[model samples]
Target: MDLQQRINAFVQLGTFLREISSESISKTSSSKFHNQIPQILQAAQNNNRWFTETNIKFAFASWGHALTETTINSWLSSYSITQKIPNTIAIIMAGNIPLVGFHDFLSVLMSGNKVLAKLSSNDNILLPFLVSFLVEQHSDFKESIQLTEKKVTNFDAVIATGSDNTARYFEYYFGKYPHIIRKNRNSVAVLTGKETEEQLLSLSDDIFQYFGLGCRNVSKLFIPKEYDFHPFFEAMFNKKEYINNHKYINNYDYNKAVYLMSNIKLLDNEFLLLKQDSGYSSPISVVFYETYEDLSELQTKFSEDKDRIQAIVGNSGIAGEIPFGKAQQPTLWDYADGVDTMKFLVEL
Candidate 1:
């Protein structure tokens, strides 16, 4: 009903997620939600093979850490948030990783607005189930959230996320409305050949987490010229278990085959492929590398192509560069595309 009530409900949801994440849901906890965890997890994996239990749980764990009362208050404190008439905001979600569109959903409701969400089929299970948990926390939330299969209309504004092609469609259809339309963007890492083994191993998480599907996943690397691949490959060895996922292995094999057939020189570690490329987006099991002459030049390049890049990960001193391994662990205010979702909603 009110902002505090909404925040309280989400705090409850966060506690539930933390319990599930830690495998410590007490017997006296909300039995219905707790009992449904296994089914929800199974359905998520069944619906999208990319939604492995480990990754889904990690997503939950990340959100659990994020939705604390202190953090939520701190994030929202910057906005005025005084809307007398709530707008119905439609959200087009992306299922690349678990709950990828949740920030928008959270923003709408927290800003005293209704949500009309079109959940990506690949991620349909988790958010709706969590919505059920939230509604139970406060019945008022039921009227605030709507999940739909038909064309989304009767909304005051739109926030859509999709590939570059779908973005064109979104632009054609929803461009007239107050909107934020996002397209394909990738994250990259800068390796100065000075990172410690621990840092490199952590950086592997930035690369391989969610099998490199999320926009935040580091799909490219900027290494100094003549930087040996041996240490980098060795650090990545810690994530060799990713090869065990059949879907991931299939991509690795198929991409490797295609590259080999094309006569492209590749550095292979049996599980992952390293290729010299000038591009940012790489195949699922491959990471693109480019040699950098100077960090200042790379920063200038990133500045010029800011829209195409989501995050720059490293200690290269690039402005807003995320440290290694923390790309996926974005804070509540870490807007995707660097556009403030809360400001957009509040302004509406």
Candidate 2:
């Protein structure tokens, strides 16, 4: 399909998602796939317990909002999306969160490349179904998108996301080809001890969303040394219902017990645990905090460790920091790992 055709297809898909998530379908554009959403939601939850309907729908809503014509055009305006000899771009998607690999998929397609996608077993359902809708929108897409479980082969380039261990494997296997290989990265929030109650409550979303599984979820905090835990804990109370998720609660209990056994001092609010740690990747249901005597010093540390961090959430006036509660709601231009996928693709 041509570039405009591709853009139009995605715009329609965006409309479909917005309608499906809101259950206010009033357009015939998505009629073919409209009835399939409920079944897809159930099947996704059944296949991956972490893919609760709420999170999946939230993902849908996020993508729906992002895929609008205005946003898409604005994002693409800087690029010269000229039709080129199509290259096959194979994607190794991560299943940590719903549609985590979608931006890569969109990048490859929008750059006029063929998609040979290896869907993560934990998240194999949703993207293909959406691709089906795209194919229906324009028959040309039927030849452009291929989802597979077998070892991917014969691609011009590769984009893979995984843990540090799997990233090594990806490098070994796909290193000969042009590639973008991403490893484990976590987001962190900076607390100045002056944030309003509203901001802290919003920060809770950065912590609890997706059960803290996604890379964008804040796992670490940089707080002033004398910062009180009272307001932070109280704000976290907003998401106390996370305890109702059996899987989440199991992690909390297990981590809490393990920490207690080690005699590690912890601040517990019954539902969440806070521990002093120098590490970035905290366990699910636990957030690591480190006291910062100077925000400027911490900023320098972040600069040195940028590769290990996916995002920084705060209003500390730090360059490139994401606002609290907006970690999961990245704009189209927010490249993961700070690598520009479209630039890489088009230049190839």
Candidate 3:
């Protein structure tokens, strides 16, 4: 099928999802499109999957809804069609969260290449189920996509995602091919101290959505030294019902223990942890904070770590847009590591 046809297929998939009830998506019995998360989690524990079931659901929902056709088309249209499409793409999926490798998958397929997908054991459910739905909608997509349970080789190009450690392995193994090896990244927020109460409440979505497991989740905050964190804490407190889930409580308990044992000082309220740090990507529900003297200095610091940052949150007047609620729901132009993936694919 042509690229436009594929785009339409995706649009239909989104429509199909919207038509189904949340109960249907979460249901387990006799459903063609069921997410077999428990089984997938067990398999991942015994195999190569490195993420959790929660990660998978969040990634799929975020990308499926946020990355729309208009966005994809705009990116693709920016590239010159004189370049020939690559023939084969080996996509090494990241199990850090669910379906994190889907943008790579979409890029490869849309570029008219055959896709050899290495599923993260942690996310075995969503990708296969989504691909199945695509094939059910358009059988030709089956020819474009292939699932591999074995290690991959013999591809013209590669896109692999993993922690900073696994990135080296991907590089050494797939370096000969034209490849993009994505490493670890975290998101941060910069509070201008003039942010509205409305913005702070909106910012809470970026902090707590998906339990702060995705890379786009704001794990660090940049605020003026004199800025009082009380309003932010109060906002989070209002959303206490969100953390009433047993899973978040368990994470809070576990992380709280490690923090105390390690003698880390944290400003703890009822639901979140605000500690001091100069980095990004903290553990789930834990956020690091640092005071910046000026936006220029913060911008310079951000540029230095640009490769490791996925998105920047907060009310700072910066190049990246401020995302509210889930960090994973990035807009079309919200390239990972600031790379225009669709442009890369279209130019291939």
Candidate 4:
């Protein structure tokens, strides 16, 4: 199939998957879908068919809209597919959040490159299943993608994501090729105390999605010392339904203990903790904080750690927009760890 046809197929798949209820989506557990992900990854690797319908649908819906043909055409028109696309790309996926490697997958495919996906062990199921489903729908896609569990070689370009520690390793190992290596990032929110109840409530999603495991999940809150955290706490407590999971409770207990033992002062309200620290990105139940006298001061402080800050919440004068609950639901333009994958793919 031609590139446009492939893009159409992806959009169709996205629509189909989006129609499936959240309950249905959740029911298709990674375990049940594990075997299929390899096929999906294979399709993506083989035909330069990057996007699956499920991913497109999620992306569109995540952005609170439908993917239009115009949008697809516009995106495709930006690239010159007259030349043969790159044959292969090696992608070392990250498991920090569900479907986090999708943008890279889409970029490689759309730019007409075969993918060699080093699937993250933590998320071995979803991408493969989605790819398999697309391949089943379109035979041509089957030739384009491949999923391999083994170490890969001889790729024109590489994209890998990992913690700050592993980024160095990826850079050293893959630096010879055109690569984008991601390091740790933590999202934070700046609370001005003047926030409306609705705004504070909305911020809760930024704090708690995926139990705050995703890099985009806020692990820090910037608030003035006198800021009354009760309203924020009350808003989050109302959504205590989210904390029902055992994993979150365990993080809460562990972090809570560390705080107690260290004698770190905290402001607690039933389900979450607010503590002071210079760092960004904490565990599920805890958030680090720093009081700022003004936005200028906050900006200066943030500038010093720009590499570690992913998404900033609150009323800060920053460039990037913030999305709620879908901390992992990046748009087509959302570059991972702020690196441009599309540009990287196109360059190759």
Q: Supply every candidate's count of residue pairs whose N, Cα or C atoms clash at under 3 angstroms.
A: 0, 0, 5, 18
lDDT by residue (tens digit), candidate 2, 201-276: 9999999999999999999999997889999999999998999999999999999999999999999999899999
Candidates sorted on lDDT, descending: 2, 1, 3, 4
Task: Choose 3 or 4, whichever is better by TM-score.
Answer: 3
Taking the tens digit of each residue's C-alpha lDDT, what string does model 3 give over 256-297? 889989999988885788878766767776899999887888
Where is model 2 poorest over a 10-residue stretch in terms of lDDT? 23-32
After superposing candidate 4, which stretches have Cα over 4 Å from the reference?
22-71, 74-81, 321-328
Q: In model 4, how large is the Cα lDDT of residue 234?
A: 80
TM-score of model 1 relative to the true fold?
0.98
Listed in order, each prediction's TM-score against the native is 0.98, 0.98, 0.85, 0.84
Order by TM-score, highest first: 1, 2, 3, 4
Error of 4 at 235 (Å): 1.1
Q: Model 2: residues >4 Å from true position, as ranges?
A: 24-30
Stretches of candidate 3 off by over 4 Å are: 21-61, 67-69, 81-86
